[model samples]
Target: MIISAPSASEVRMSVNKSLSSRIAFIVSLLIVSVAWSGAWAAGWSPAAPMLGPRSLHSATRLANGNVLVAGGFYITTVWNFPTAAEQYNPSTNTWTSAGTLLRGRRAHTATLLQDGRVLVTGGESTTSTLAQAELYNPATNSWTEVAPMISPRAFHTAVRLQNGKVLVAGGAPVNSATNAAELYDPATNTWTAVPSMSSARKQHSAALLGDGRVLVAGGYSATTPFWSSAEVYNPATNSWSSVGSMSTARVLFPLVVLPSGKVLAVGGNSGAGLPPSVDAFDPATNTWAPVAPMGIGRYVHTATVLANGQVLAAGAYGRDSAELYAPATNTWTSAGVMSSTRGEHTATLLANGKVLVTGGSGGSGHLATADLYSPDVGSDLGSALGSGLVQADTCAATNDSTPACSAGSTAPDRSFTWTAPSSGTFTVSTTGSSFDTVLSLFDANTGAALGCNDDVSASTFQSSVAVTLTAGRQLRIVVDGYRTRCGTLTLNIQ
Candidate 1:
């Protein structure tokens, strides 16, 4: 048997770009297999994978509502780091190249800045523990190295401040815990030293409080056991002060700020073994209280607060089980299990209220599999869409030819609400549709006709129409066949 992996550069390129977007699409999607119909998919079924298999990477959601996954190593016989990066679109359920990083890194921090760019900080590459820093501009889709940090550090935590700066602190794994802390200002593109923590913390957790303070808590020091000590950083004063201590010392746990503003630190290695116990810190009271324990001990897991205000704890070292924490009861219940065991992976919340879980070390090693967890999906396709897939069989048959299609166009149609991200002139097409098609645009709320077309650029039947859109414009897109026939069709806009 023959085997080969796409190089890092092969997979990272911009998608939906102007001028030959198809070429960019082909080049960028050499590894990822993004398709059109994941809405029909069920629980934990595979969505598209990334450009390649990776672990210990970071996933940050961009302002455009796309996910930026950057820099993780391949587990092909040896741990190999890659500088490549990719973006995932929840709307299309596709993966495309965001762009490569300036430095190859793993175990790093990627934080989204206020200016719609991303700040990537220190982590290990093939060469060494890196102090290198870079910024990712989504508008231009490129990376530029910024000023390196004052110290070479990895395994640190970075939280975007309320003041539009980023606070980076702690180090671990490859390096000993350091109380060193610094701030990165996007305005000046520089890093400045800040008051360090009272004690060293590595692989710790950080959360922004409602009052604009940042709470840093629990992680291994450079030596000995992990610490239960916690502290808060006040941006106004540019200082750190010791706060209430946790009941247990842990490493690699999740610190999630609930809707009520209390921070919940859950499930981690408590010096000896993984513990399911959780701790809650109330900034209002300045105290730490013990909460309920999980069904199983888990470390290196991911926790995300859902729209419904429930916290989902997923994937631990060698475990596929998941649990949900309820704030009202302060308890954990079995949520379910993933299709496979995953640790060191990422889970992102999409606008549609579904959770997207991506690459990590799974039971088979570095995972290329990704899946969606949505409360809406069911086993049957018709029941899933609530509209029987809403596809037209023929282009000219769905409507009476109103200067668009021929007189016979009628039957088989689909209605969709498209939310515009930006104000622009967009060309919507059913170019490669399976049959002759007619397209129409309508106001989603009023059902008033906005635009209609039967053919594009003197083509036979495929439809294309240009529409001017404003940000947050809600549009209703309808497509139908031109004759007494029905078939599948793919839609695109650029």
Candidate 2:
């Protein structure tokens, strides 16, 4: 639910249903082109390169639409992992040094906490396996060390729970796989041990299911069969149970929940080599079934769900080719190719319908290059609305909120700057979403915060705010999530 607002009454908005309907009509036209032409229009384009070559780095999209790239091995004379971090600004198409972590780390997981801070968990350094953990504040562009994990672990998986707690499970503790798990409470800045996995696993995959349970699948285990087994963790019970095993045992695969509530286990490795064999698990049935194979086999690859409901499988140990999986037909199709072959890399889906792929080892070597894959090249708001009175009815943006707004928020904010078209009152709402959202209107040019609405009368999980606009006035709208809620935002604006 949205945090309570301080205002006694809603602003002077008359609830212009007609205006909102017109905006929806405008958005429908914008997406009609997408339906006709298909989303994957443009291929790969090079973005500003990172300051240093990196591989196995963690890239987390901040609440304010910026990406944080941190902790990866770079090649100079030899491979070296640096604690330094960098921020990527999509608006400016440039990279700037964000800050530095307390210690050099690689293979760590950086999760955006419910309160907008980044919790960086265990990763290894040149000398030791790391039990150390840290927090990154985007506003301060600095890192703060937090309570360490129970043990040194790398190649582990961490997912934010529905209740704002973090669940970290399955990774090598010192040298081999461990089933040990722990919970990190952001409010307490503390960690407590939880039930371990049914099996000790490393290099596995985990995803939050629709029911709030986490499904972890196929990874290397201590015993030997390279772990084809799967398990599900129930937060309510604080335990894990064996689920249906994948048809083929594999490690280093990606487990992702689809829009249909089905979980996909994509390309990965068994004992021998990377296999293109793909599988999907139906939560409703508690069973696993093989699906269409990827065009090519890839281990250490990445799968990202597109706005169009297709999944893009990109990069592998030696392959640079990418492919897309369409659930409608249960088929795989070739996507664009990246500039460099990538393995142990990261692919993050940006709010603008593009995938941002960052540093990894490839055919050339470890890379610092970044690539933006636009499935819908014409999806940019500016392209459709162009210098207009109103933009699209619905749009997606990462909140990437500043430190100032994070005080009561677990989600980041997305800011929109526009010149007012007419002098009148306007109503902005997040009525369509299923999660709590915060809406604020602003004087964009002066950087002044205007009215803020944490919740609307219609729903606690949604927000609506009204503010008057003057012709030619510089306006900005910031949509922030109330807590740990950052995903595609179907924002409604007038």
Candidate 3:
């Protein structure tokens, strides 16, 4: 069932049923206020670097579970762009060079087609922006050129639509920018002009939302020097509408469509250089708000959403550092550093639950070294109480010396008693809007973490945290370190 939007009653019901356990958790307030202190404060180790080292490139996933990385400048030349291509096999954790492009290029866009091929569009060679387009067939491992675009352009926005057509929008044709837009039909291998944007832009970012609309935000405008203005494109109506402007004016930024159906605009350069700014836009309200900021300023970077609903914003033209964003808390955390400092590289999420980052300019020049980011199983929530569990007066009348559960302590947590469902192979679970907390199942006879292990790769925020418990017996439930004081959590058994 497609739910375009749900009413307020639906939202409240979800909150109540979902957070029943958390509401029962009685603790203090110290833990809730200190939750955000962990943002980018910790760094995870990267999996491994890819084979080659080429920067200013693009990478796309194939239907067959492999990734295609192609074209970028190499070495430190005035612009020694290479047409070389490579394919990565996630199953084997290896990379094999594939067919190269007919022409060397950089800063191009690659759109994955429905028929299992990828359409490579315009980019700059050593001299000028390209109008040409090409197609790559994974079956034969080759590239074939199609008809050129009506206008020569590079750094333009290209999107694959529901009808199997690709829409190419505004960018520079010469040294100057243009508002022109075009459509490409793979069925005919031809290009046709669509409605031009209200403003001309380049180095902007575009994202397709769940409701079949594309939100285009931030880039340089020909009229203004640079822009923070944003707009939405309705492919069904073939029209554009001004949405909202960003908190800061930036170009060469990255846009990610979150699981919640909201759009997040990450770091970018402020015309003269890069800036450390992160903002989110809600299409439902047509507004933007500041979220967490990145640790470092970045432009020409890549922001990729993982299967687990976390976003990995990695690689930028100037820096090698990367960060992960958790929508559950609207915060950013450092996810470890890359093998090399890269800018203009491509980060592609593989089907095997790993992200493949390939090719970009590593300070020295264009590079080909690739890296993979694998998410950890997550750790236990420990003994810390998370933010936002209903803190009722556990000792309203009798206990006045200590902070009551209702008033909450600087750090508060919820305690609950559970009768084990059965004896064999039982586990605890939760459904709430908090952290990825650690769940521990204890013997009613014993009050220790499961197996006496403190780190269980799961952290509780608002949802239920469960560990396997001995069946037929009683167990204790405790949630540590919630994401927010305002967030809710529910505990249960499964």
Root-mean-square deviation per candidate: 11.0, 15.7, 15.1
Model 3 Cα lDDT, one tens digit per residue, 1-494: 11123234423643432343223321212353333221111233333355556666778899988888877677643557777787887655567877879888777889999999999988888888899999999989999999888887777888888788888888775557888889899999999988888788888888887887778888786678788989887888988889979989988888998889988889898876667888999989989998888888888889998776889998776678888889898778888888878878888876645677776777766665666676642332222222211222111122112111112222234455555545455445433323323334555566554522212222222333345444555665554332212223334344
lDDT of each: 0.75, 0.76, 0.67
lDDT of 3: 0.67
Candidate 2, superposed: residue stretches over 4 Å from native? 1-41, 377-494
The candidate with the higher TM-score, 1 or 3, is 1
What TM-score does prediction 2 earn? 0.70
lDDT of 2 by residue, 235-272 (tens): 99988888879989888888888999999999898788
The order by descending TM-score is 1, 2, 3
| Model 2 lDDT on a 0 to 1 scale | 0.76
